[model samples]
Target: MADNTAAKIEADASEIITSPRVEVGTRGVNRVDTVYASIMDAMSNGEFPESGRLPTETELAQRFGVSRPTVREALSRLRLDGLIASRRGSGSFVLRRPDRNIKRFAPIESLADVQRCFAYRIALESAAAGLAAELRTPRDLDEIARALEHLDRVREQGTLGVDEDLQFHLAIVRASQNIFFVTALEMVGDQMRVAMQLSRSLSLERSKVRREVVQAEHREIVNAIDKGSSVEAAEAMRLHLGNARRRLFEGPQSE
Candidate 1:
């Protein structure tokens, strides 16, 4: 059973970002401003507006009067936060709506938003993975693996694997096939996005070094449910989330 995948919304993240008209901090002046504006505009109207296909790098650059790199950087921020998805050689697309939870955030206060969101999400999603094992389909396995492959690439390349990372989690929830399961997953999507974005500086390899170990745990849970080991599956999920909360939420403070 898989435990990931959020519902899809049709809209472009770039079409609606907002501009504050000034430089913020250590980041570059105009580009960051433009990117942030675009992002905010998009978020202001909701993460994606239904009017257009998710804008391309070139299109965004042209719209903001910045380089494609600037747009890419901005998109990268959204990517880690689970705001956008890209299909190789095709283009990026906005999925879910960025509800008021993310939209109503205060100017300076949004930084911690991600952490809070993830703290909540970890609890919901870890349990979902376990449930999926018993509720998933063979087709679900294929979908989950595809996301996993993308995650592996991000780990190896030592860059943000935001989209892939979210995909993996989303697949798990989808596999669970429980409406409540999926609803729980959506409830935390924005926060999960924030946590993932904030943690981008963390080394994917170093941070996710326990890939095989974590994966082994996943397999246990998966196999348990595949074989109808409900107790085992549920326990596996409990343990998985317990570890994640300790490391991500209550871990030793760093700056």
Candidate 2:
């Protein structure tokens, strides 16, 4: 039985090791970031083996058509995000599989786009959250609560939960009962979706304590809105987004 099991494991590893390479482009984009994103998407799509082991640095570099230094830098970022870990003799391995169901949105091409998206969301969503606090009905509160509940459940499953997060924000906007707020969100729906996905992806890569902190931030906004404190709700929303921005771009220490 032991010999048979060993043979099966070897076979599985061999098959996974020979999987197709993912090539990334270099047109007006950061190569390291593009390589990292490509690897992440490949993993999420089950291109990697169930054993969690990753291809060697040389193999990855060749596959991505970039320099070994570029691949190393990309891998370093993945390590910092806690998505993969290195073993002295065994190479690097993935820690978890990203949610496969995530729909492809407009790719976040650069750090500048990330910064601009967060800034726009902070101004737009905070206002909506504040208005919801002042003008929400029980039904509006219920929608927000349901969305929050969905987010918590998905988090427990260790997924990014982008859809649930977006729904929570949309619920608040709906509660505000202002057509303009809803319209504005819809106008940039694709960008907002990508931003939410990126933020949640980072959150998933961090510690459990960090994840809980994000959830707590969501609850704070909900509680303030429930109490009809527009000022408190707006402040909570602004602070939450600010911290999210810091966590993503400025590092966890900044948050």
Candidate 3:
């Protein structure tokens, strides 16, 4: 009986190893999202039963052909979504299967999709900025400043700085200290990255003047937040997003 049990464990491990691999760095999909999707697929198929321990980070890394850090990031997102729980000295365990009805932002594949993404951002981020202005602490300010500095440095180098731009916006969202806002942003992270990439690409084609204008707008938002003027912060964010939307749809003439 013990020999049969040992063989069954080995077979299960082999089945996991033979599972389909996640392709990292795919366009329109981030590494964490890829890993998360793969794990969720496994769960949906009952390959990972509830209350059953998941593969260790090392095992998942090897199986998925990704770095352990990538696996860890995927696991962190899973924990945040309440699909899994981790215990000290033990591996992560499945909690509940993912809800298929959860609304997720689709990839931004066209100009229309880009406009839609910006519309969502304008609504979500403008409110987040106002709340952040009223609720932010010194630590939040420091984080926002650091992200802005990174963005400025990248701009000075004449790079589009899509990642830096995303970081700046994410820092502001974090400053709001609202879990719902943060989670909402996190759910659409890939779409947001794509939108940022396209927006920056368009701005790059214009001139340095356009880039400087964006930087000025960012500074305005930060200043309002630092001053604790919630109304000003919201308006600043709204104006910035509105300008971005115009630039995206109406071209450089709108600038």
Backbone clash numbers for all candidates listed: 24, 0, 0
State the displacement of the C-alpha of residue 112, model 1, in Å, after optimal TM-score superposition.
5.7
- Give per-model TM-scores: 0.46, 0.57, 0.56
- Please provide, for model 3 over 97-213, each residue's C-alpha lDDT reduced to its tens digit, 9 standing for 90 to 100: 543222122222243345446657777787788889989999999999999899889778889898898889999999999999999888888878877776776666677888898
| Model 1 agreement with the true structure over 90-169: per-residue lDDT tens digits | 78776443433332333323533443354355456655665676678888877876776676566667677666666777
Ranking according to TM-score, highest score first: 2, 3, 1
Clashing pairs in 3: none
Per-residue lDDT tens digits for candidate 2, residues 1-255, read 334433533454454355334334656556777777787677666787434899999999889778887888777656654557899999889765544433333343343355546656677777788789989999999999999899889878989888888888889988989999899877777777777776777666567888888899999999999999887887788789877765553234333
Full-model lDDT, candidate 1: 0.55
RMSD of 1: 16.7
- The reply for model 2, stretches above 4 Å from the true place, is 1-109, 250-255
Worst 10 residues of 1 by lDDT: 7-16
Top TM-score model: 2
Candidate 1 lDDT score at position 211: 46
